[model samples]
Target: MAAGTLYTYPENWRAFKAQIAAQYSGAALKVASTTPAFTFGQTNRTPAFLQNFPLGKVPAYQGDDGFCLFESNAIAHYLSNEALRGATPQAAAQVLQWVSFADSEIIPPASTWVFPTLGIMQFNKQATEQAKEDVKRALTVLNQHLNTRTFLVGERISLADITVVCSMLWLYKQVLEPSFRQPYNNVNRWFITCINQPQFKVVLGEVKLCEKMAQFDAKKFAEMQPKKEAAPKKEKAPKEAAKPQEKKEKKKEEKKEEKKPAPEEDMDDCDAALAAEPKSKDPFAHLPKSTFVMIEFKRKYSNEDTLAVAIPHFWDNFDKEGYSIWYSQYKYSDELTLTFKSCNLITGMFQRLDKLRKNAFASVILFGTDNNSSISGIWVFRGQELAFPVTDWQIDYESYDWRKLDSDSEECKTMVKEYFAWEGDFKHVGKAFNQGKIFK
Candidate 1:
């Protein structure tokens, strides 16, 4: 067994540590705090530390193989090899894509938006604004893609969601104001789902949505500025003539203290004050209860069969009125086009499905071009019977297995049916899936 020590802050650094601990239960994972006070006499910065990690960064891992690794993402990748990596080559590739996307796209903007305000890094107004803009832009890209799919790469939880999520944990905790995240609803929903997972909870603890900080107001800020002292009054001359008292008018006045309000009146005032205070709404108020049917569509079609036979059949026979079509693609397809245009194609399908009142969600993916050459995924319809036509692909449907879940019992056939009817509590299950493509 190898001993791995992570030198980092508990809050921001715990996600990575938790992932490793949860996945590789056999390995010993220790926390070595680097907050100057904690690290003063720590072994992390000693000569032995330099031998392992020259940079002396927190989260450097020394494997049982005597191989040492640094960089949180890389270390997480190394740690999650068997536990988080997909069983197939394609699954592994999707994981890599998501991890890379998290590192390259998510971390930069998050660091830019959060670090300065926390006083952890130098503040640059222009850079912060630019970073926010970039963050929104990147979120838009993710939202557009995630609007249809549950997870990032594969059919199950993968390293991609884990790593990128870890990177953004800081921003979600500190920087993302409600006003900022609300517009990115899909992103928010996805993030909430990820953090709420049991494994994540163990590592990251319960992630609460931080209250949005008050915006800077110029007038209020000015009011808060310390007032300057007025120049000392000019000293009076030493010699002063005595003044005679003037003749006076006669009037006697009595001063009296006003009585306070009665206890009943005070109670009413307190009640009024309580009533006047604004209450915050639960962001998940609209989220449906977790009840759904998982429909698995397995098809083996040649390139020509997918385009010439399968796709048209799907559009024509798909239960447009009863079921929603989620356009799914393999996480590993090289021929797949990567552009905003392809994203729009999927978005358009979702829009059309919205008209049907079937409450269908769709996601498209291109996986495995890297780790494995194969790609696959499924379009999940949450209703009763799929109203659409089944083309050539073999199809199977099963309600969410209640036996596996610890939450609700009472077999939820009605709940599943209601999900299809767009009735009852409807929650988003953003599990990653392995989906194959259907060409039209």
Candidate 2:
């Protein structure tokens, strides 16, 4: 009965929640991504958009009656009728409990364990093992609960099942291999039953369960790091023992060196451009210089006391008006596949934005695993606007939601501490921090 526009990128799991609810309720939910409508990053980053959804996050909705809302769960519940939501007040409460369970119990460990396998995050043996144990514990609980139950709440599918299944979708598809998942037979059956529902199937077509458990490929991951050439060994010989043969060898080496051609004169246009280009002029040149030096802050935070000393020092000397703080969340999360690839995407962007390092300090993080994940970060830049310019090479910058933070706010202070420290439960994404890259 309700008609509205849902703004989000394609195949977003959060958006799928609303879409599935709309399907069951016959709510006219039009995807904003269709032609002449919305483009992730660009449209959302505009000043006009901030007026509507100030956070600039996706799965944002605008109803025909001028009702506007953000956040996936709220939008989904709004789209659903009493049947899909819950039959009774008790059922509704139970449904909410399961939804909360999915966020709290299942997603954190699931993301930590599975993201590294997907290559979105670098794997740490100790952390990954702990994550696996946590996942096993959560799954055991779910399996025990579902042993006699058809659904997460009551009979028939509800918002609880939809939200939970969507939350666990990537776990089943990415790293919950048969061997790992076989112990939780009840959970598997419940998941299968839920996905088979026409509403789920239509929204999430043909869910492919993981065939083989994807293990961390270390050598392949090592290859991703910039390699270092081995140091040449020194050969010691008595100077007096120098002979004619040594001279001949030196001649031979000289000949070999002579045989090597000089660097190529004709290079690709990109390389030529890069070579011809002077070191970038300071993009933040226009902004008033800050009294707080970034390098000092980095060294103090990294080397000195993190919370006790560094935080106090930062706030005491922070040039709030001169330097701006912004939160930049990765867009096109639906396009993210394989955990490693997602992390690589972040690394690649960081590498490409070589221009931003001098003026910006950021911590871009990869959360969750393959097929289901998100990349987001907090950026502190020299100027009051996004540091990266709009260009072909800078296209990736557009694929992020940017919001300025009030440096004086408690939320800003907390974000700085959590993001810089790379710890804390990031409630916005509903997943624990997996790994982060610091743009120092």
Which of the numbered candidates is closest to the native, going by highest lDDT? 2
TM-score per candidate, chains pooled: 0.45, 0.52
Which tens-of-lDDT digit does each residue in 311-357 have in candidate 2?
A: 78888888877788999888787887776567657756764664555
lDDT of 1 by residue, 1-440 (tens): 44565555445453364444445434566665545533422444579887887865555666646787877776676666464766678878877777767756776667656654554333334345657887887889889978887887655567777876777777788878798788888888888988888877777778877578423243543333223334445445448563333311111111111122222111111122332223334232343443331221112121124344434444444443344333233332334354323433443343334322223333233222222222222344533334233211122212111111111223333322322222233222222212222111
Worst 10 residues of 1 by lDDT: 247-256
Stretches of model 2 off by over 4 angstroms after superposition: 215-440
Residue 217 in model 1: lDDT: 41
TM-score of 1: 0.45
Candidate 1 stretches with Cα past 4 Å from truth are: 1-3, 12-21, 24-26, 34-42, 214-440
How many clashing pairs per prediction, in order?
A: 30, 8
Model 1 C-alpha RMSD vs. true structure (Å) is: 25.1
